[model samples]
Target: MKKLLIIGTMPIILDMNADSSSDSEEEEIGETEETTQKPITCLISHDECYVAPQLLNELYVEIFARVPCSEYWKLQFLNKRFSQLLKSSEIFRMRQKLGLVKPYLFLLSSGANRWTMFDKDFESFLKLPKLSSNICFFNGDKEVTSVGTQLIVIGKEVEGITVWRFELEMQKWVKGPAMITPRVMFGSASHGTNAFFAGGVKIDKNSYEVVSIAEKYNAETKTWTAIHAMHKRRKLCSGFFLRGKFYVLGGQNENDEYLTCAESYNEVTDSWELIPNMLKDMPVLFSQAPPRIAVVNDNLYLLETSLNELHVYDVNANAWKKLGVVPVGAHFTRGWGVAFKSVGDELLVIGASSARPQSQSMTVYKCRPDVEEIVWEECKRCCRGVRLNHFILNCCVMLA
Candidate 1:
């Protein structure tokens, strides 16, 4: 009878089928089978396959670190090992160490409770989780900001000021501490570990009133502390952090007049200093709508959504200079829905294209600032056949 055996440090025996025969005949058959079949050994115990798990893990980390952030979600489903490695911070650390981090554009569209992130490396929009239905009941009027990889959304709900934070690492949204005051059309920005909110419209006696209150939320403590108010009441304004100070720019006052004055707040001194108005040297033809601003290489840029134009502020000169119109094909929804974020030397703008309503496309433009001119280049175009009635509510640039 022919027999088989598995050989290793721990051996296993297997019996083979055989007919009745003499002991000598059975031995002969067993010998024949042994001569024809090699001894089975553990493949993992073989010299060539004897790789350490740590070494294999290191190899996995190195290989996966180069993978584009856009494909991470799909790759996580490959296997348990792959999912574990992808979720490990070690892989992201390796990516950062190897300088593989790239900029990604994240968009929050009004009426769409989910976020759409555009991966420039792959020129694709990644699938994101849907926001909680409870969170979706609120209106789209909100202030968006980012600190590190977290995107903060602040909006006034029926209860009070609701704050939600999206963690890019875990790919989920969590409720943040509620604001002390319920306000809308607020000027907000993220600075270091805290998010600052400035003047905004508050409801008083069923009427809207612009207030001059200022506060900052400490993310670590999950608390909001009142800070010195801005020098002027600002509503429908925008705020940005630069040079260790928070700057509020271009908003309407209680008089419902567009503000030309700008101010910077010093956290250390608890004071505000008036800065040169963005409209100081601009032509009267510029729209009164507050322009979207972004900071690139410590320089400030303003995007006039109506004209699809760009302007740069000279800190030393205290003047704003027009950098001409953005790329010709760029489109905005109702002279709004445009967002600007600085990634390295490029300013990334995201908005809808001028296609028909039923076939509107979401487009991203990369603006390269030069000494003579600002060159706009198309980065990615998606949602080709999908109609997007909702405006681009908020957008921020993230690195991964």
Candidate 2:
């Protein structure tokens, strides 16, 4: 049974609508109205299985948690008992207890209303349910982050700003449970089942104010808790989690000036420690996306937008060491369109083929920057097929 869980990636279509009859809140597999579109898949292998009626349910839950959540639908074939467990959140809860998770990359491209979800290896993809809000939510700028099984998308609607969430378990877009103070251009990051949002602009009437407020969302409770605000008011910043701490890095301030400083939030102390001039030497354009930064194994790595080069942060010296250019381009757009994030231990970057040239097809590459040697390995499988919009409006990595 354990062997069935560790098999290599075998792509299979996931009909998210497979079991809509279940009344479980955590297992909303699929609710798609587009019958013409393709389905999703899971990392799987074909094998025989038999359920022992005498086996403890706890043991089964432990075993099933090892399987990818994308493959949960297939588990119904095991037996009636297994089917019941799949509909419930018991196995998912066990997964969290065991700290077992896989990252799924969600991307929203330019000029496109629908978002796409790709498996870790980019073996197969799934289109998220369309947003149920007004046109403003689609055309305006969007900030996205995922907490646990939910993918939260924030943007404006017709009359005012709104928040839309893509619930992975329910397999649909749900409106509301909005932010305590609705915002845009915020810095957001996720750790485990919780997501953190901080430092953005709040628009009311004709005026918009850059804000320093911070909030945390608990996926289980479906609620938000306000936290200690950062010492600085900045928008267009980036948020990352490292060493049990949340860090907010480089962004533009309320005065329309670029800020080189950063802030680190200590959950234990319940306070934010201002890290002044943390990015004083960082390279960026006059106006662009937040610093292209991602953390792996407690070390922070940054992409120099002007050079398309990779640099590692020195925690002791508070400096950066250049690691050479990434396989993808970034200089042309000044780092606006690139999707930079840490996928497990490797640094995953998706962008154009060159620093200056443009292409309809984006390149996908990953590298282990923590080791002695840094080599960008291109996911050739991901580059093929229908190409993505070269300019990524937003990208998020959700651990399920």
The lDDT for every candidate, in the order shown, is: 0.65, 0.77
Residues 1-400 of candidate 1: C-alpha lDDT, one tens digit per residue = 3333322232222223311222321211112333333222222333222334455456457656776665565555444555665545666677878998777777776556577776654246765687663543355466777654567777755555677877665577788666777677878777645778899988645777799899888654567899998888988888887878899987888887778888888989988888756555543332344457888778898876656678888888788778887642233343456667787787876665433334445566676785665667765444443334335777777666
**In model 2, which regions exceed 4 Å deviation?**
1-60, 63-67, 71-89, 383-385
Instruction: Assess candidate 1 and give its lDDT.
Output: 0.65
Q: For residues 305-399, what per-residue lDDT tens digits would candidate 2 score against the true structure? A: 88888999988888889998887668878899999888888999987777436567767888888778898987889934456887888898988
Model 1 off-target regions past 4 Å?
1-102, 120-122, 133-138, 204-207, 282-289, 328-334, 352-359, 380-390
TM-scores, all candidates, are 0.69, 0.81
* Best candidate according to TM-score: 2
With a 3 Å backbone cut-off (N, CA, C), the pairs that clash in candidate 2 are: 14-40, 16-30, 28-169, 28-170
Q: Candidate 1: deviation at residue 240, Å?
A: 1.4
- What value of lDDT does candidate 2 attain over all alpha carbons? 0.77
RMSD of each: 11.9, 8.9
* Model 1 alpha-carbon miss at residue 398, Å: 3.1
**What TM value does model 1 have?**
0.69
